[model samples]
Target: MQLLTTYMVRSQQKFATIFLISRGFTFQTMDFQGKYHIHCLMQLDLKFSLSFNSFTGNVPADLGSLRNLTKVTFSYNQLQTRPDGLSFVTDLTNCTKLQLLDFGHNKFKGEIPASIANFTNTLHILLLGSNQITGNIPPEIENLNGLQLLTIYNNSISGEIPYGIGKLRNLMDLSLWGNRISGPIPSSLGNATQLLKVQLQENHLEGNIPLSLGQCRQLLLLALSDNNLNDTIPKEVIGLSSLCIIFDVARNFLTGPLPLEVGNMSKIVDVDLSNNRLTGEIPTTLSQCLMLQYLDMAGNLFEGGIPPSLRTLNGLQYLNLSRNRLSGQIPIYFKNFTMLEMLDLSFNSLEGEVPQEGIFIDTKRISIIGNKELCGGIKELGLPACKVHNTKKRRKLPKLKVSITVTVLFFIMLTCLIVVVYWRRKSATRPSTALPTEERFLKVSYAELRQATDEFSPSNLIGQGSHSSVYRGILDGNQLVAVKVLNLRQKGALKSFLAECEALRNIRHRNLVNIITVCSSIDFTGAEFKALIYDLMQNGSLEQWLHSSENQSDMPKLTLIQRLDIAIDVAFALEYLHHHCQTSIIHGDLKPSNVLLDHDMVAHVCDFGLARFLCGSTNLDASQCQASSSGLKGTIGYIAPEYGLGSTSSLLGDMYSFGILLLETFTGITPTDVMFKDKWTLHQFVKAALLEGTKILDPSLLSSEHLAGINGGQSGDVDKVRLEEGVAAVLRIGVLCSEELPVERMDMVNALSELCAVREKFLRHGM
Candidate 1:
């Protein structure tokens, strides 16, 4: 036997390697007794293979000496782990070129080692399923950036999925089902945009199925049944038009109406929404999924007659709509379902004469039991005959009531027309401003501004600045405008008014706020009046989104992608000012409050009250701004460090302001927060997080997903790794631009380019 083993090892080693790598469980030996001796083989990088063998004992720890080993499999064996856990798996670190390893379907018992992450980046597939392996999945597993698949199912492994796993950019499949894994499915999973299949069913995972998963436009199958998951399924998931395979989330605590967007998944084959606590009627829009088969929506609270549109799914098989509140006659279309193998509509309120043809001819293939109202299929089934109801006629509305309704609608339209005609004539009769120019689109008087803004009412006020207050107003032309009314009582109000006018007088860009018209006239009381008019932003300011004030709670949140676009918009505005414009204009204040969003959610950089044009190299014109002083021209917490020391407002100073703006926007933490006390600035706070490897991002950024075009599917960013890297780049730019020394800062041109690249990579492939 020893001679035969020696000859086989020498002559067939290379051929066996090819066969072992090509197949699984092909070397079973029922007559195998005691431990199959692995040490007796001529050891030249043993690419081992095994099957359902009785080979008992610890996996040899000497595989470290077989440095050239590439593929190894010992599935369905009796191999067990030593008392110290899978410590031998650590020895494979020496085999740096190793690619694939499988120990599944074995008797191996112990915790997976964190050191397994130390394996070569080429190691793409690792299977440890059907074992007694236990303990938490180590967070260090994120280091395996090249891993395409990781299957550790049917094990006793426990604990939360590490948040860092979102960094696996190449990961395509992750199967951790039938384990003891608990805690929330990481929203970061959405960042793995390449992910195709995820099997996490029959686990203890809880929390909402992240809406971010909608970003996986390439996702095919998702199985998440038998978990502690609860929450209304995100409509984005239903709108995943690419989810053409099975969509199973049964046996969960999910609630709320399934969104009508479910119709978007028209090509899905198998759908199982059974045993959930979902409410509301089955969406009739579900008729759009025509390729459906093996549909199981049993044990839900669905009501209403099944939509007749479902008759289109002619290939349906194995349908189970049992234990629901569904009512109405069973559709006759069931008799035509030639491919249907099983049909269970039990415990429902179905009432009809069941068809005698098709699957209904055999009681064994279908179950209509517990539905008391159902009757008459076949004599062998022994059901009572169904009864028909008498028909009734419908009533019509009174002619007198209909005539009165029409008269009221006519008067309402007539009144609106009269009001519109009066306003248009009034607008034509008297122009508002003391001086109206063709350059401006709209011209309005003090009274017109006052009237449009509800008599300068407090309710119409949208923003407040140091020298001005902005009020939302609608012109006679039905156009929305933001009226920046200057406070003559303030110290620098006059200079700020001139600075803003001069700064905006020549430059024009889409991202820059558009000036509609200015009003420089007196009121009825004969007091001074000066106001700047610009396009009214429908979505409000970035400040409201980041840190919403008390009165504005309904403001929609900004996702990572939206914020990135806003950053780029602001960058474009800044780039045009510093390079594209006739002269370099410094936006002295670049805080969140100064950035507004138009109706389309496109960002526009606003407020140029502190803007200054560079006359030459290092000098900011004296008349342009009173910015070179300890008091500073811009708001505190955003002013460049040099500004506090009485330094001139150069282009570099603007870079510093933009730097602080980026940090505040991404972190969602104000520069003036109490945490930045004791000489600890926001710059240092973010710099520390990056340098220390303790990554931090806005809580909203992490929780949100990339839901583009599906009911305003907007979240932070789509890909987590790209998100992490993109954020790191932005923060690094912030640090460099906000550096104490002006020369150390990143230039605006380069910064703009860097920002554009970040957007390109992060948003290249999301919904």
Candidate 2:
């Protein structure tokens, strides 16, 4: 190893070519002493990988001596461009067979040299992201016609994206977010028919979204948020059928009615057009989007009632129409939105009594705030009681009319008697709880999961939390799933497994983790193999976003809107479990790690290991609710203060945990962060920061310059004190919900209401 580092023994090992790669393990920086021992192996024509290492210092120009190199990956290292700058890139042009150049997540800086055009024609991917690289994308880059992916996001690259980028006819992915790039999207981009994902958000780009982009029929993800783009969204762009992943155009100056062509994107899973000037009624044609799951049209000028056709979307999970001019009664057919979890209709001119059916039964699941004319929901919403007027004027009825009325009443009585008798007999024979309520997507045996997860291999493991080790697996139907194998040996693990089954059996909500099936069969060893299966979340858990260091460079940090959405999602899930379900459930352990994000970043609350039934009523005491279970109710840092006094878990405890979660999400500091000592806590830290307007806010939230305009800087811009007020209001709710005294803490409905109020301000003024 020493000789390999120094090149002193290159004569003895002239055949050495490839370097060992480090992944999933940390390594200390080892000085290269400016050596290039691998140059002797130029005849071997081997690939070199020094990725995921801690190597530091500038790229040595001596590396150019390896003319036979075909792939060079120095990703996730501290390597940078030499002080002479980008000269190393000029040297790499000598490697005639080079096909891949990956220098992502490094300290590389300075302009990409025009000499990049000299790279071998075989080069297909240029991954130079997460660096300090600056300067315009040179038009010479178009020479790499064979390039498929070019990602330089999260860099200091600026100036208009070279129109030549569209000339890369074979390009499949183009990501240039988190830069200062300005100028309209090139119409020539339509020429790249193979493009799959295009993310140009968080830039200074202005002008209309080019209609030519619709020509890229293979596009799956199109994100153009946090830009200065203005004008009406073209109908051509809205009709793309292949945009099935996500279509986000939020935080722009878009105007005009939503195109009816939106219905053509039937396969898309998520759509966001919030914070725009769009007007006119929502297109009823949206009903044609059968696969839509998440829809957000908040912060727009849309008027008129929500189209009744929206009820036809059985798979829809989230819907937000808040902060709009939408007026009219809430649609009665909303009761048929069976899978809908969260609905926000706040800050609208909607009228009429709020419905008390389906998701509407939970005041926490629906928001009618700012609609003063709305009346009557569940008692918790505080809407006025609906009025009834009984004024009967009996006119002398004709003999024929009286005779018909009497006959109809006689038959109604006879039918009622028969139904009562039949129902009584049926009720005596079977219990209501015996009926299956939760939908099962599939049923698979333990053996199938074993095969799917390679006999429970360690490499298949995706998570190990809440007494269950979750493994990634693909079933026979090509369905991706997360198989959570229980650790029954742990204390309370068996009980938790049973509790989860009971809790999920009769409950279904879109924001809650959707369970596919459960396995209770014996393993190959004849011991029990208890496991729960769910849809595999592509983004993993919120904890991974908040703290995971393994892939921080690769994963995008959560934005303010994303954080708000996730917080709202968790609240909806909690509201459903606590107040909407047939039997109230207390998610005893509510924390960031338990919240999972699907592919579209929609949150799904998971991990029911500490979940339990709140049998009696909403006001049940902790001991009464936990009589059937034993052991601690929550994780150490998130456990309610009352729980430490030997009290059993309650819904209020879950609210407390949720409050902490909200605080952590914004501050990017967990309750157990080392900064808290003595009497200080996460609450105290935030409380102090709120007063001082200190920069305790997460840096990721401040990355976009536009936020300063939305968030109302300390100078107090009048167009948006509402934004600052909303921020303070969110922190206040966090404090109030997590108060030490349970009696003083707000209920889930009130907490939800406060959040909606804050969210309304954010949407209406802060965008």
Candidate 3:
């Protein structure tokens, strides 16, 4: 150790300039006076970038003696104290030539000392974000006249922004969001005309926007939302022609007519003025902003019809004028706005038929509700007709008696032709004997299905399950379909196959996979069976994406919110089956493998081979009695425990399966994996984790702590925060649906209400 120390000192003295170490090093307290008389040897260097590599002990203040040093970087390191604890780089002021400095992403704490002003002459970029720095921005910061970028976000800073901040004439980017800064925005900030991006949201600032901000002509993004700014939007803001992006003034107390001059910002792309008190008719001039793509004026007092001029905005993709007092007929010209993807005009007084052409034809993407007088072409809206009635007209008719003679002759010829045509078709296409509808499946010829599937080729197969295989096919001039062929003998096992067919034929739901038709036939070799056809799900089954190792690279990982969405969709399907069907249908098998996804990743339940329909007072014991089934009937891990005890399939079984699926979604782990066995089912795993605060689940699936910070809350306190009130409601439904006892669980209606509550919350929160 002594030899190494001697070598380091001898090297430091010879270099007298910058030095860098290629490997890790450690250090302890050193006596500056005894260290090679270091004060006079002004240029000292380190062998490695400073980091948390076991460098302990206090930062030596005597190191300031290196007056010739120009750069110092000590990020991610554990220095005991800032070299000058209560001051900012004061000891290094003697190093007048200092130009670059980086001390970020570390454990620096306490207020940034006002002495930071001493670097005013040379510092160009200052990044103190992502640290433990606290306290108010010192008024002395106005002295950093040469500073170009200042980012102090993600800290515990407090107090008002200094009014003299306007003095930073060279400042181009400033971000002080995600802090506790309070007080009115200083109008003097308008003096920083060179600023290109200004983010001051999520603060406690209150007051009207200063009119002088119009002077920031170069500003491209200005976010001041979620504050207490009041009064009308200053008209002077219209002068900022360089603003080409977001112009959000949501959630404020701003009132009065939206400025017509807003249309003059032709380059603007998005404008949000939601949750304000703005009144008056939407200005037609807004259509003049050709580049505008998103317009949200919801939760306001805007009135009158949607301006006809808006139809000219072919680039508009999202438009929301909901929760307003707007009145008048929907303009017929809306057909011209073909690019519109989302249109919400709910809770308005707008009247007239919703256009059936163009974007409105896609009813799923539009919401036009709460307008009592409004009528529409949408089938689900149940809107009344608006055609005017006229009841005073008369017409004369000519009598015809001779036509009967010609009609009688024509009927005789038609009857003979029908007889001959029917006989020929019956001989060529019909079967010798027709089975009763209740006992028969649609008779599609084996040859036709074989052609549709291109000779049952492996390349045409879309999916496969334990008891069946699914193939994609094009039948009858290009009608795409998925054919699920059950692996069962056709002639001898008619009863069992028919029962499965009857169960699926009777059920219907948007989220339950739709069966288009069925094929039953015998082939030339005397083999026969039944196959059900359904709409092809473009994305295939969820199980393949979630569990197949070979397909892992192709499958997209679902984010937390997407997983929550899929869970809700599956719950709705189960709820519908449990309550809305004429005779309750129990999808005896509910698992990710049975749930398919469409192009949008919307889940659809498929494969109803084990499904059973329950009639009133039916003997469930006999009805649910099955032939010897292998494995677990359903997927191994998702099968309800009661099913193993010979319990009749019930809604509770589906709930148990759904609970397992939910846990799988949250943990990104399959319930049947070996790692989750022996009292380690997903249900037990999640329950244990939440109960004991253990790290049993993958951390990547958890939302980051900083996400709460974006909404003006503490990162560490997020778990303590209640699930969003509406999400809490849905969660209650999930809890009720997954109750251990069958009788305690909620019926489909109640469960659906809970799920709808989540959608309501999203609508209310403008998500």
Which numbered prediction scores highest in TM-score against the true structure?
A: 2
Candidate lDDT values, in order: 0.79, 0.80, 0.68
Better of 1 and 3 by lDDT: 1
Tell me the TM-score of each prediction against the true structure: 0.48, 0.49, 0.43
Tens-digit lDDT track of model 2 for 559-606? 666788888888889999988887789988888888999979999999
Task: Please provide, for model 3 over 341-433, each residue's C-alpha lDDT reduced to its tens digit, 9 standing for 90 to 100.
Answer: 898989998877777777677768888879888765766667787676576664544445447766887999999899879877975763434
Residue pairs with clashing backbones, model 1 = 191-720, 432-444, 432-445, 559-715, 559-716, 560-715, 560-716, 561-716, 707-713
Which parts of model 1 are misplaced by more than 4 Å?
1-34, 37-46, 388-767
Residue 151, model 3: Cα distance from true site in angstroms: 1.6
lDDT of 1 at 669: 87
> Model 2: which ten-residue window has the lowest total lDDT?
1-10
Instruction: Pick the winner on TM-score between candidates 1 and 3.
Output: 1
Off by over 4 Å in 3: 1-108, 333-335, 385-767
Report RMSD for candidate 1.
Answer: 16.5
Q: lDDT by residue for model 1 over 1-767, one digit each (tens)?
A: 11112122221122122232221222333222465444432234445565545556777776666666777787776788877778878877777777888889887888888898887487888899999988999898999977988999999989999998888988899999999999999999999988889899989999999998887877878899999999998887766766778889999999988886676676789889999987788765576576788799999998988766567567898899999998998888888899999999999998978889998998899998988888888998789987766566556669998899999999999999998798679768753432324544566799989866757766457789779999876666245678999998999898889889978876789999999878899978899999998988867888889997543332457877788888889888998999877667888888888999987889999999888887563434664444433256788788888888878778898898889889888889888998988889998899899899777778766654433342345433434565677778878887887887899999988988888887787666452
Q: Find the candidate with the highest lDDT and give its number.
A: 2
Which of the two, 2 or 3, has more TM-score? 2
Indicate the residue-level lDDT of 114 in model 3: 74
lDDT of 1: 0.79
